[model samples]
Target: MLQRPQANEFDSYFTKYVYNVGDKNINQFLRDQEQNIVHLYNTLSEKEAEHRYAPGKWSAKETLGHINDSERIMSYWLLSVARGDQTDLPGYDQETYVNHGDFNKSEVAALIADFQRARQSTLSLLDSISPAAWVRTGVVVHKRVTARTILYIIAGHTEHHMNIIKHYGNRLT
Candidate 1:
């Protein structure tokens, strides 16, 4: 029964992501999301996965790869803060990461598999966090955030991308 973080717990830029989360138990929500996302992605054929909604946008596979990368980074932030790490974590450039990922070259099933493994690792790390540590704060990209804030961001970020991926349905066919 982890509580939702307060408005002040995270940066204002993250409000959309945090607000995307509902009243559901964070851990359960994450677990359910993992399955739902996998099922959604599994429905797409490899050729379909390569379809971008428009020019200059990410393909479905690249979007999933971005989601996987973001979750891993946020999970690391969660772990670092929960463990009382005082170091200021650096932010990454999503474009650079995605360009280097070469997700377009991989099978859709393989991308989904990578997502599953990354999410499972995130869940395991979440389980290891102590009750008192949820309130632990750390700096990321120069903004102070709590461990719980990072958790909500992770969930919200996925939901944001999921919505985008769903919208691709209209054009993918």
Candidate 2:
């Protein structure tokens, strides 16, 4: 029963992600969202999986990879910050991550499978934390953030990309 994070607990830019969470239970959201992602991925054809809605856009596989990458990093941050680490974290370049993933030639199911596994690890990590640690804060890319905030971001970021996947995946011909 994690309460929503306060506006003052995180930087303004992250508000959209947190706001996207609304009043839902964060842990339950994470668990259900995992199933949603898997279902979406399971519905895509191999050709659809490699689709890019327009020029210069990422393929569905790449987008899925990006979500996986983000979850892994943010979950690590959640772990690091919750444990009272004060280390300043650097921001990741999404484009670089997408380019490096080479997901275009990989199986989308494999990517989605990886994401599910990583997400389970994240869920376990969050569940294992002390209740007080959820409020722990740390500096991330020069912005002060809490473990609770990152959890919201983790869920919201997936939602954001899943919207993209649905939009682009629909455009597949």
Candidate 3:
């Protein structure tokens, strides 16, 4: 079995999921994420997507929505960090967000498409930045954070959820 990544493995699950992405390659982790989203989407059947791994846990659909919401927020955080914003970033209430999210009513294909589009948009924004910007820092959830750290967290965060989908009461549809 693939060893689980540390609980705090990727520093911030927000960036570790997508760090070490090749600067020379445009694919740069974001594409990988889009692909993973698609892969997971395709893996689940219509009924399976609605399956909840456990009582009170998010269903596959809700998990996809979580990924979408997180990427959107993290993209903004990335931009702020790149711009050297020092203000503490706001904390998100995942449970609240999921509760308010209507993923249960959304189609699987749409969720995948939305995630891909959002990720692509974020990557486009990131690709336009100067190298110096990558070193800039910002505050996230009241903690000092850097642009690079945010990127890694993105990848690691996805990986974290992927693990859950794979083992924590979920399986390939």
Candidate 4:
């Protein structure tokens, strides 16, 4: 098990919550997680994906959709910050996003494909950045965060959600 990178390794551009993700490069981590995500998605049938562990919780489809949305938004942040933009990025309302996801009606296969596409785009964008770009600091949600830390946080956030899906929803049944 690889422990997260130390705090000081990245600039303090991110909020304490995200900065806590430590040293994993956001793009690299997402690339690595692709295999695990694919495997997990493939293991489930349409019915399995729709099954939620509890009422009001997200189903597997919704979770996948959320990951796709999250990656896309994070990618946008990465792109702007990587270009040396110092603008403050706004935070999103996750509950609002989830409520509108319509996961119950979406096909599981398409949802995962959307996630893969978004992640791939994010990776391509990150891979193109110059070394100096990684060190740039920007504000998000009133906290200073470096591009490097942002990347790691994005990856870790997805992993965190995936773990929840596995343990609570996917594994329960």
Best by lDDT: 1
Task: Supply candidate 4's per-residue lDDT for 162.
Answer: 84
Highest-TM-score candidate: 1
**What tens digits encode model 4's per-residue C-alpha lDDT throughout 1-173?**
23343466444543453543446654455677887898888888898888888988888888888888888887788788778888888879887898898886998778878888887787788668888787777776766666766677778778877888878753546
Runs of candidate 4 with Cα error greater than 4 angstroms are: 1-28, 169-172
Per model, state how many residue pairs clash. 0, 0, 13, 6
Error of 2 at 2 (Å): 0.2
The ten-residue window of minimal lDDT in model 4 covers: 1-10
Per-residue lDDT tens digits of candidate 3, residues 1-173?
11222333233534435443323233445576577668867977878888886688888889989988988898888888888778788979999999999998999999888888888878787777677776676778876666766765665576678668868544433
Q: What is the C-alpha local distance difference test score of each model? A: 0.92, 0.89, 0.72, 0.75
Q: What's model 1's overall lDDT?
A: 0.92
Q: Between 1 and 3, whose TM-score is larger? A: 1
Clashing pairs in 2: none
**Model 4 TM-score, all chains together:** 0.84
Q: Residue-wise lDDT of candidate 2 within 1-173, one digit each (tens)?
A: 99989999999999888888788999888888999999998988888888778999888888889999999999888898899999998789999999988887878779888998999999889868999999999988889999899899899989888877777666975
Q: Cα deviation of 143 in candidate 2 (Å)? A: 0.3
So what's the TM-score on candidate 1?
Answer: 0.98
